[model samples]
Target: MNTSTHYPNAPVAQPVARHTLAVIVDNEPGVLARIAGLFSGRGYNIESLTVSETEHDKHISRITVVTSGTAHIIDQIKAHLDRLVPVHRVVDLTLQGEALERELALVKVVGKGEHRVEAMRLASAFGARTLDASLTSFVFELTGSTEEIERFIKLMTAVGLTEVSRTGIAAMSRGPDAM
Candidate 1:
């Protein structure tokens, strides 16, 4: 005798995908807070967020938010954002084909003698510029993809890495279209 069991009404789980969403809104006080509140209230995680006024004359600001979730969750997030009073537009850059994303980081390393030399060498290899230098410490500025910055910081650990500050990812679609 052979037996098999199956549930006909079982729900299938969708795979989670990372998405980069660009949001356009009025450049006014409390706009950022409202956006953040939306994510916090919904329990959605924001991996990276960057916001700045894109159109000074028009008083429009662009927010780049990197997040991960199932397709349904992403859709819900976008829909909720659209309902917000200040939101003008929301674009999923990840699904919009080719896009360019970059971040800036400032890394400080404290070293002496050979350690300092090694830090300089590694910075040069990573195309980082020395923004400040003293007898015992050096501050390097680097701009690149998130992974590149992480790798550079990891490598610097062996050369007396001390502190770091990073600007979250800024992304935009390629070609002539404006977001």
Candidate 2:
């Protein structure tokens, strides 16, 4: 006689990691909704998402999604996404070495006198362009990494930031490979 115990149902916790995924899909109505639905339905959170038609003739679009999850969850997300009929390819840009990522922001600042001068000077140091300016307010256009944009916004807030509009991150892998 022998006595043995087994606990196969035990769960193991894994550290969460942030990933940037580039998905290529058919450019058609409802595609973006479907992708969003998949994430929502699965209870996954999207930190940032950007989509645009990349190849007009090919009728293909690219979606860049930033999400954080355990390794297992990330793998499952990719697998499920690849199984979607309209999905062409899913590339994990985060795991694919260094990639280029950028975001664009339109910042509007309202100030007078010294505040206005400081705002413009800081903007110049950050390489921000003056898109529109009036006696009391100025609208600047900035393009850079997310961190850079955030830092600029923070600095502007102290001066007189009034409004801001941002285009979510758009990223791609570096080198000769194409996605």
- lDDT per residue (tens digit) for residues 49-161 in model 1: 99999999999999999999999999999999999999999999999996799999999999999999999999999999999999999999999999999999999999999
Cα distance off (Å), candidate 1, residue 85: 1.0
- Residue 122 miss distance in model 1 (angstroms): 0.8
Tens-place lDDT digits, model 2, residues 1-179 = 34353655557679999899999999999999999999999999999899999999999999999999999999999998999999999999989997899999999999999999999999999999999999999999999999999999999999999999998889999999887
Best by TM-score: 1
Count of residue pairs whose backbone atoms collide, per candidate? 0, 0
TM-score of each model, paired residue for residue: 0.95, 0.92
